[model samples]
Target: MYIHFIAIGGSAMHNLALALHNKDYKITGSDDAVYEPSRTRLLQKGLLPKEMGWFPEKITANLDAVILGMHAREDNPELQKATELNIPVYSYPEFLYEQSKEKTRVVIGGSHGKTTITSMVLHVLKYHQKEVDYMVGAQLEGFDTMVHLTKENDFIVLEGDEYLSSPIDRRPKFHLYKPNIALLSGIAWDHINVFPTYENYVDQFRIFIDSIVKGGILVYNEEDLQLKKLVSETTNTIRKHPYQTPEFRVEDEKTLLQTPEGDMPVSVFGSHNLQNLAGAKWICQHMGIDEEDFYEAISSFKGASKRLERIAETSKAIVFKDFAHSPSKVMATTKAVKHQYPKKQIVACLELHTYSSLNAEFLREYQGALNAADTAVVYFSPEAIQNKKLAPVAEEQIFNAFDRKDLQVYTNPEDFQKLLEQQHYEDVVLLLMSSGTYGGLDFNKIAEWIK
Candidate 1:
């Protein structure tokens, strides 16, 4: 089979390209620009376009299908050409559904815990030597590509994102998966630019629930009232399974899970992660994995990349970086770290990078989100706002929106780095939370300074 990608430089797109290439399918892709890891990986697989930018000439009748990335606009040249030729076109999520239509599809969805839950399931399955096709949001340990596909795999585990499937496909990505088994960790309003209101944002999850295949199972976080309401209202022909934070305790800075075999020590911690583990456990159970076997495998799971990932550590201090820009994610991450290291002084810094996070209306949702930290800092670049064509936000507005009078805000990366460097590292933990690089600040350099 031959497949062509329009805007293949995306994290997920490039991974999918490589996965298909590894499966012995002919893969070709074009993008105006390609960045680091994706570009490097594509070149390594000999899938990188000889030249960047869309080429309508590349779209031919012989191609089996054209997979579109979210980065590509509806009017993208290659996309227009594909439409002209009447060649089969698919949004990434749509194509995933097509590939796994005959297999048991397990989709992990939620506002915050999707990546962690997906990673946990993948880790447990790998531990048991279960062969499965998968697409996870984050790069995980022991996984060469974030996406993997093979003819032998009878199941596909997908990290279901609530965001749009493609520029032309306005529907949420998760709606296309039609999972035989699904998990929703929690619901928190996000993507202000698209959904606008919290109620509208939540409606997407409800749609996802209605889209599940008949007789499927839904594993959801019962602690979230929104999720509870959605699940209660759903009349779909699917079994509902509710999960909450499991029995766990922190001992000497280690999180131990209470299992039938006794307290099994795990590398991951926090109420959010524990809830994620519970959700993943239920999904694994549905996949024919027993609780004991699941716990035994999960005990060694560290975490998903950039979801409270430990970047650097010393005996005196530790530094963590998390891809947490949304209000709920920021709150959970900050609270989790503080709870995990109660004795340490916590310095939590977050960057307002995404369009939703920078929107004036959405800023109010972040009220007191960082209050758990001993010291809280928020960063935003005026240049970023301009680049995204968003209305400029003042530091005062951000500070007031957070409702934290003690919060420190920065518009400069150098000053932010200097402020961090001045802090004494002894008995302290630094958490940097952002979806984008903090104005291109070098995390390794900052780690070295703190060390």
Candidate 2:
């Protein structure tokens, strides 16, 4: 198959490009801008476009399909050309659906735990030597590509993102999956630029629940009140299974789960992760994996990349980096670290990097999110706001929004680094939360300084 990707530098798009290229399909792509590691990876695979800007000539009749990334606008030159030629165009999620339509799609969806849940399922499947096609949001250990597609794999595990599929495709990406087995981790309002109201953001999940294939099973987080209500009201033909945080105890900072067979020690911790474990367990059971097998396989599962990933650690202090820009994610991560290391002084620093987090209206949702930390710091770059075309936000506004009078806010990374360097690190757990790098601060350098 010959396929072209518009805005191919995207994380998912580049991964998909590499996956298809490895499959020996003729792959071509174009983007206005490309950054590392997508740029480096694509170049290594010989998939990177020779030049940066889009060229209408890249779109032709012989191409089997055009996969559009979210970065591309509706009027992107190649997109326009493809439309002009009536060539088949698929949003990244839409194309994924097209590729895995014949397989049993197991989609993991929610505001926060999607990546972790998807990673857990993939880890267990790989442990059991189960051959499957898959797409996970984060780069995981022992996995070469975030996306894997094969004709022979009968199952496909998809990390179902609720964001808009593409600039032109307004439907939430998860809606297109139509999974036979689906999991909703939880619902928290996000993507303020798209869905203007919290109710509107929640309605997407309801729509996603409605979109499941007939007789499909939905394994959801019963602890989330909103999700519980939504699942209860849904009279769809699918079967509903709810999971909460499983019985677990933290001993010496290591989390162990109480399973039917015995107590199984795991590499991941936190109530959120425990809930993720429960949901993944249910999904694995549906996939014909029994409780014993699931526990054995999951014992080796560490975690998804950047979802509470340990960056550097010393006997005196430990540093963790998490991709947690949303309010719910921030709270969950903070609470997890504190619960895991109650004796340590938790110093949590978060970057308000996402559009939702930086927006004036959406900032209020973050109230008390970082309150679990002994010391809370919030960082945002004015340049980022300008780049996102968002109105400038003041530090006071952030302080008020978080409802923390003592919240230290920073507009500079260097100053933030100095603050960390000056802190007493003994018996402390430093949690760095952000979807973006904390204004490109060298976290390793900061970690060394703290150590």
Candidate 3:
């Protein structure tokens, strides 16, 4: 089969392009700009476009399909070419669904923990010598690519994101998967720009549950009241299995799981992660992995790329970088770190980077979200707001949104870094949270400075 990918430089898009290429299909892709990892990997595989930018000429009638990425605008020249040629065009999720329609699709969906839970399932499956076609959000340790497809695998695991499928497709990506086995980690209102109301944001998950194939199973975090209520209201003929944070304890900065085998030590910690572990376990159980085998394998699962990833550690303190920007996520991460190290002074720094986070109205949701931290710091670049064409967020709004009298807000990255560097590092844990880099702040240098 021959296929072409438009806006293929995206993390998921590039990985999908490589997956099809590995499957021996003729694949070509075009993107206006390609960054590291995607650029290097595409170059290595000879899939890198000879020239950057949309080339309408590259879209040919002979191609089997054109996969569109969310990065591409509706007026993208290559997309227009595909339409003009009357060639089939599929959004990334739509194509993923087509490829795995025959397999037992296992989709992990939620406002958070989708990547971590999906990675856990993949890790355990690999440990048990089970081969499965999979697409996870983050780059995992043992996996060569984020997307993998095979003809032999009977199961396909997908990290189901609720974001729009593509510029042309407004449906949530997870809604297209229609999983036979589904897992919803939890529901926390996000994407304020799209779904302005909390109820609207929540209705998406309800629709996702209804999308499960008939007689399919849904494994959800029962601890989440919103998720629990959604599951209760659903009338679909699907099996529902509820999970909570499994028995676990933290000691000397280490988290140990109370498994059937015995107390199993884990590299990852916090209530949120433990809760994710329970959801993963249920999903794995549905996939034919025994409880004993799952626990044995999961003991070695460190974490996903940036989900509470340890950037650096020293005798005095440890610095962690996490992809947490939403109010609920920021709260959970902050509380987790404080819970794990009760004695350490926790300095929680979050960057208001996304459209939702930068919106002044949405900032109210973050009230008391970072209360767990001994020191709370929030940063948002006015330049970023301008770049996104958003209304500027003021320092007073930030302070009131957090409802913390001592909250320190910064609009400048240099000032933020200077303030951080001047703080006493001894007996303190630094938690850096953001979906974007702190305006190009070097994490490694900050880690060293903290040490």
Q: Give the candidate number with the greatest lDDT.
A: 3
Q: What TM value does model 2 have?
A: 0.98
CA lDDT of every candidate: 0.92, 0.92, 0.93
The parts of candidate 1 lying over 4 Å away from their true place are none
Residue-wise C-alpha lDDT for candidate 1, range 1-451, written one tens digit per residue: 9999999999999999999899899999999999989999999989999999889999999999999999998889999999999999999999988888889999999998999999999999999999899999999999999999887788999999999999989999999999999999888888888998888999999999999999999999999998999999999999999999989888778788888888888888888999999999999999989998998899889899999999989889999999999998899999989988999999999999999988888889999999999999999999999998998899999988999999999999889888888989999999999998888888878668777
Model 2: per-residue Cα lDDT over 1-451, one tens digit each? 9999999999999999999998899999999999988989998989989999989998999988999999998888899999989999999999999989899999999998999999999999999999899999999999999999999999999999989999888999999999999999999999999999989999999999999999999999989999999999997899999888889998888887898877778889999999999999999999989988998999989899998999988899999999999998899999999999999999999999989999998999999999999999999999999999998899889989999988999999889878888989899999999988877788778667667
| Each prediction's TM-score versus the true structure | 0.98, 0.98, 0.98
> Candidate 3, which segments miss by more than 4 Å at Cα?
none
Q: Between which residue pairs do clashes occur in model 1?
A: none
Candidate 3: tens digits of C-alpha lDDT, residues 105-151? 99999999999999999999999999999999999999999999999
Model 3 TM-score (2 dp):
0.98
Off-target runs (Cα >4 Å) in candidate 2 are none
Worst 10 residues of 3 by lDDT: 442-451
